[model samples]
Target chain A: MKEISFKNDILPLGDKLYRLALRITCNKQEAEDVVQDTLIKLWEGREKLKEVDNLTVYAMTVCRNQALDHNAKHENKNISLEDSGVDGFDNQHMPDERLIYNQRYEIINELINRMPEKQRTVIQLRDIEGRNYQEISLMMNISLADVKVTLFRARQQLKEQLKKQKNGL
Target chain B: MDYKYIEQLLERYWQCETTLEEEQILHSFFKQHDVPEHLQQYADLFSYESEAAQECLSDDFKQRMLDMVDEEPAVEAKTIKFVSRITPLFKAAAVVAIALTIGNVAERTMQDNSVGDNAGAPSIADTYTRTEDITATIHIIDRNQSESMAKADTVQVDDITRR
Candidate 1:
């Protein structure tokens, strides 16, 4: 069996993991943390990774899970604040009116960020990451059909947003 | 140059029917500044995809990760190996210490006896005192009498004559 070098084999997956995490978490710091945690996990379990068929996909899956967990915790924190009747707790996803008047790309970014986690991740993996449906399915642990469906919904959402942006413009 | 192909690809793209290559064609078509005004709205989405893929971790992140992985277990392994490697030597030292303690105790006891007795000097005096007691009890048996006693063994002729 060929030896797996962390620097060669695993570290290169950091950016992919970061993109997935950032797509899921919508925060750079949280995404970086998720990637760091995922890499450390892969390094710690490198001994058992020999049996893994696709280490890259496995790392992405782990990063995705960690990112989702962070998002869940963050939402829960926000929910708790809401429950406590905290006033002026601004919503992070709500874009200001000026951002709508800014570059079209920011609006697209905002729209992508507002989608469901599965849809956002599916778009990130399929379109941005250039991953096939099979690989996306494997990374997300979803069926192939589900990956396409999620991606279709995501793309359709973007189309609707583009239409709305055009009308607004 | 008809915009029909891109328009069709964009339609298929929205329907999730475009192949990856077809999608790349659309992305490339949109990247150019000559994008027809009618198809311009979709360009940002494709361009975003292209640019977002370029997003990467900072330069120091990889170094930080390497540092984290490299530092921890090495220190732990060094400490563990050092202890494991020297444990037997420690046990051997403990055994030698116990043996030396027991030897010191035994030697001290022996020395105490030797010092108190002055190396058998008191035993010689004790023997002399015992001999004197016996001489007084037997009233100074001469050498001839001792020889006669030895020859006669248990028969005491002197005692019989006195009787």
Candidate 2:
């Protein structure tokens, strides 16, 4: 593929890849590293780019695998969510609103992090990344039913966590 | 704003029956400030989802990534080709070195035995024993000097090197 075309077509998926990596690794620097590695791997395999039907899905798979590998390697180390910082949703809000938003974001992010990796990833792909079940299943290399089952569990767990948080649990 | 529709969607959301768009609608609905008293708690969670989705790498990161791609050697394929071509040469060189070393050792051993026979008396042990003793003495002297120097540097003579 032409370098210009590749960059134009493929690089825009970086944001989606970043979100997946962030959700998986739960740290900004590690997520960025994963995305960087994913992009480099994609570039290395650019010769086979034509065979890919959906570049976004392909790129996401690469990013997910790289993030998983990074998580595996650093499994024994404590992952700090502090590196995500109090930005993104912090701007344009009053102090009280910002605090509330941050608390809620933290709670939900933490709840998602608590879920098993497969469940969390499926939730991310289906809910946050807005991918369909078939697409997510394909990207995740799992069956459609497996994707649905995982997403079901993830949403159920998230709901339970949210309810518990509401009850001050 | 009325949240009856949102409340229903929220139920479906928990059941994993909502589509991505419907889920997005819930997030948008909850992002506003007009949720009823009973549903306020769920607002933060949905709004948080919207906000978390927006968390992404900075522009500086994007630029750095692009620069990295740019910095990658465009001749990577050529370099791989070159390495493949020279690999056989390296293997041949390694083999030749090993063969030469073995041949030299064998020739030296044969010459040594012949010389020993001609000389009629000097054993291999005799030839090695003097050098071994000299090395041992030198090592002992070096060790003693180092030990003394270490002790002089420190007021306490601790036997730290306990081998």
Candidate 3:
């Protein structure tokens, strides 16, 4: 309900926003840019946002739309989202354990990445980000029921996939 | 130790009936030292969930954003307020000032050349003298031609006579 300060409010959301955008766009750089653009856009539209509660969720919604729009426009690019620094995990300590950890995590990420866009985003927000169903529904602009349905499908798919590859681990 | 409660929560989790806190308890149980041998398969999912949440924008991202934000406002303000609103006024004033200066200087110079023959620029006297003034000066020079043939003078003779 107050003017959103970029430093106190929007800048701090960069990680959460980036994670959401990364979930939606599946590309780290694109996700990062989406967060940047979302911040700037919120600043530009601060006057309109004065009456809006929960600027972080508002910004997340805006960021998601931007990411979807970006994905749509560059649909032809077809660059593998994994190429956006899939090796971002730190590997200096516990080289052997870290290697194994990275491999399993990479597989996990790959499985998650292969999910449908909506399902993947729902999983990232609800499971990874620990956001509640109501907040995710609001951010995704979908009904609470739809959020549950999407998450259900995503969890089922992830369980089956992880089980199928259990021997390889 | 018994693990029936977590297993039930996991079942409820798959059914999408678990509350956020219950789901979190499931994640916490799986994240521990031992995830129970029978239920180990779900470890990666919840572990990955926790790990992936740690993914974040790069360190410099905040600095870059602040730089961009700070830089944009100063530039926009300058363009809108100074260049658009005030700069043109200064430019027009400058042009008007230069025009007035040139006009005033030229007017005074012309006045001096016309009103004061000897005081004005001597070059303008030859080019812009009236016909009567030229003729009168020529008569004076004719009367003094013999004495002035040497090209010496107490008075300022017209430069043309020496040439």
Candidate 4:
């Protein structure tokens, strides 16, 4: 087999790794930094990765660790909760609908941000990124059962919070 | 799409019993343009997941990383296998130490099992090899003996203790 190029085989994973980092770190700039560190670390360990069958998962695990490290050192203070969801939704709604959408989305984001880091990260991976439970478990360094339980708690909390909002309770 | 099945899946979902496929089905169901009015309230949450996935690193991220990668020392990327990291001398020493420890532990456990099980038989615990070369049966017999004995003791202890 031909040797894998860093730009082709490795760098293309940037977006996926960035999503994972952003999910873990919750700060875009720090997430970007984490992805950069993760990619560089992988490149340094490239010789070892040649034997790895699934580089994407390997890169994800690396990204997760770096993101968590960045999260600890930074305390996520760089995050402005207001700006997080601005780019999350497209501007296809009517002017009034857009305002309502922003309000509802901000509430949901606050609820999600208030969640324990593990539960929120699990929700992001499973719900937003559409990763399987096994992959989430590996990325989080937790068991499969733990992944499901965390996700269930996140979803249940989201449902309850959303329902309360709907009822204005 | 049948809304009833999706409702059931949503229920199972809240219960943490829904399979991944069922969860996907719920997302897809809510993705439809005209979600039934009753279910419309949930449309935002599921759609949020879909929309949020669109977030990606900026275009400049790749170039920044590539530049950083180029600046790093070329010698840093050397391939050092995990096994190769430890000197062969240390590896041999580790192998011997582990074997000796396992053998010693096995001897003690065998002695305990013999005393505990038969009361009359002395634990021989002599299945270990003295040379650096180790026999597989030595470990296997100890593990099997311990496992089966533990299982038997568990069943008996539970059966009689309640009475």
Candidate 5:
């Protein structure tokens, strides 16, 4: 196995790890701390990391566990309203265009965040991260069938909510 | 202005039947300004998924992590057999598999799309090792915090100690 460099191989996983952490923790500061702890832990175990077949999945597993541990400790099960951190549009877009875009997305974001952890995490990994069922199963430590069921519920919930919102619900 | 393919894909998408590539196609279709009126209701859902992936940390956070890494000491490696670590997860997976029941409609939908059964999780000795490292680090942080309560500059170490 090729050796893993902390800078080239591991540091670049920060965003992916952060997204997973944020999905689980639902707090940006807590999510960042989870990623930091994950990175530090990864770096400390760099030797063992090389022995692992898939470092990305391994790193993610550790991150998921760490974030879960955080939630367990702090009882932060509900997603935070303050940390939605709406994405900004580029300057090229007109003000009206940007406002409409942000509003639509923010509503969708709220709908997603309101979901249960397993459903939302599946959506995060499958929809947001674009991970395959196999990879997601490994990272979440769930069966492939379970992954699909969880994602199915999540997408169906989003569809129902989106349709209602469109009808001015 | 034909959108038959997209409509079919959207149907599959709601059923969790669409592949990742097909899902990306939905996202791209919705990104355009000229989405058909009927499809516009679904646009924000796909668009949000695309944009949510772009969420990330700032460069300032990167710099702080680098500094903390520099300050941290080297970790001692321990030798634990791989089987010992993964045996429990296998049991857990078995339990989850037994407990998991796809609904009749979803199970039928999945029968057509099912590709492969899940093999057991890969060896992850590092996970156990990581748990140990965290426990040890927390112990150190606790000790330092108690001893250095008077010091105003314990903030750096406190960052790592923030579980």
Candidate 6:
């Protein structure tokens, strides 16, 4: 691929990469670092671009690996809320609306954070990112059945947790 | 207030039977306000998933990432250049070190062979003979110096008798 085309083609994957990184790392700064590292890796491997059938999936794999590596290194450290650091959402919404959304967002974030890494990652890919099972399985280097089972378990767990939270547990 | 469909989906959700689209439907249905009291408990969970999807890195982050990529080519090029420059020197040093080691070994071996030939002995025997000869030479020098001091004392005694 021409340098310009490579950049144009792969650049659009940033958000998807960011979301995947965020799900895995759960920290905005770490997510950004993962995305940066992923991009650098992709750029380094630009010569092999033609061999890649799905650039997005390849980039996602790289991002996921980077995030997981970061998580491993910082496994024992506490994840401070202030560590998200990057505020991607608009600040212009009405206070009440922001409050409600923020509350919902925090609740969901907490639930996702509580999930096992694999389940959280599978859910993020299957639900939020809308990737098919086969694609997720391929990207994550797992069997399709594994992907489905993980997603299923993740959703089931989320439901149970939500139910308990609703019941004031 | 009609939640019979959501209630059914919720049952399927727990059983892991709901498709992604169906799960999304459940999320959307529960995301709205005024969920019936019976279904309210599940609302927060689905709504949270829906909202969490929007948690993403900012545009500024994307721009910064692109900028970093933009800088990569230059950095890579410089690194390649740096390595290329240093590699020849490393190769030359390696070659010189190998040559010097070989030369030093060859010289030591030649010296050992010459000494062996002069002594008409095996290399190890020659080496021992050389060490023994050095020690004997030092002992003979020490004996000659002591005899010379004794002779000087006798000559002083004769000169005093003549006076």
TM-score of every candidate relative to the true structure: 0.66, 0.66, 0.70, 0.65, 0.68, 0.64
Model 3 ranges with Cα > 4 A deviation: A79-85, A89-94, A167-169, B72-163
Clashes of each: 0, 0, 0, 0, 0, 0
- Candidates 3 and 5, the one with greater DockQ: 3
Write candidate 1's Cα lDDT for A1-169 as tens digits. 4656678888999999998888887777777888998998898887788889988888998898888788787885533221221122244554775344234555666788778889988999988988888899999999999998889889988899899889998
Residue by residue across A1-169, what tens digits does model 5's lDDT show?
7666677888899999999998887778888999999999999888798789888899999999999898888775444466554434454555987777787777887787788888988999999999899999999999999999999999999888878887984
DockQ pick, better of 2 and 6: 2
Q: What global local distance difference test value does model 1 have?
A: 0.81
lDDT against the true structure, per candidate, is 0.81, 0.79, 0.82, 0.77, 0.83, 0.78
TM-score of chain B in each prediction? 0.44, 0.42, 0.44, 0.44, 0.44, 0.43
- Indicate the residue-level lDDT of B28 in model 5: 89
Q: Score candidate 4 by DockQ.
A: 0.36
Off by over 4 Å in 1: A76-102, B72-163
* Candidate 5 ranges with C-alpha deviation above 4 Å: A76-94, B71-163
The alpha-carbon deviation from the true structure for residue B17 of candidate 2, after best TM-score superposition, in angstroms, is: 1.6
Top candidate, metric TM-score: 3
Chain A TM-score of prediction number 4? 0.83
RMSD of each: 18.0, 25.4, 14.8, 26.7, 35.3, 21.5
Candidate 1 C-alpha error for residue B145, in Å: 90
Evaluated at residue B157, the lDDT of candidate 3 is 63
Measured over the true interface residues after superposition, the C-alpha RMSD of each candidate is 0.9, 1.5, 0.9, 1.7, 0.9, 2.2
Candidate 6 lDDT (Cα, whole model)? Answer: 0.78
Candidates, ranked, lDDT = 5, 3, 1, 2, 6, 4
Interface RMSD of 6: 2.2
| lDDT tens digits by residue: candidate 3, B27-103 | 88878967787788889888888888888888799999987788655645665676578778999999999999999
Residue A15 miss distance in model 4 (angstroms): 1.4
Interface DockQ per candidate: 0.54, 0.37, 0.54, 0.36, 0.52, 0.27
Q: Report the lDDT tens digits of candidate 5 across residue range B56-163.
A: 988999988887776433332222345667889999998777666445567877665443323434445435457778899899999998778746557767777895
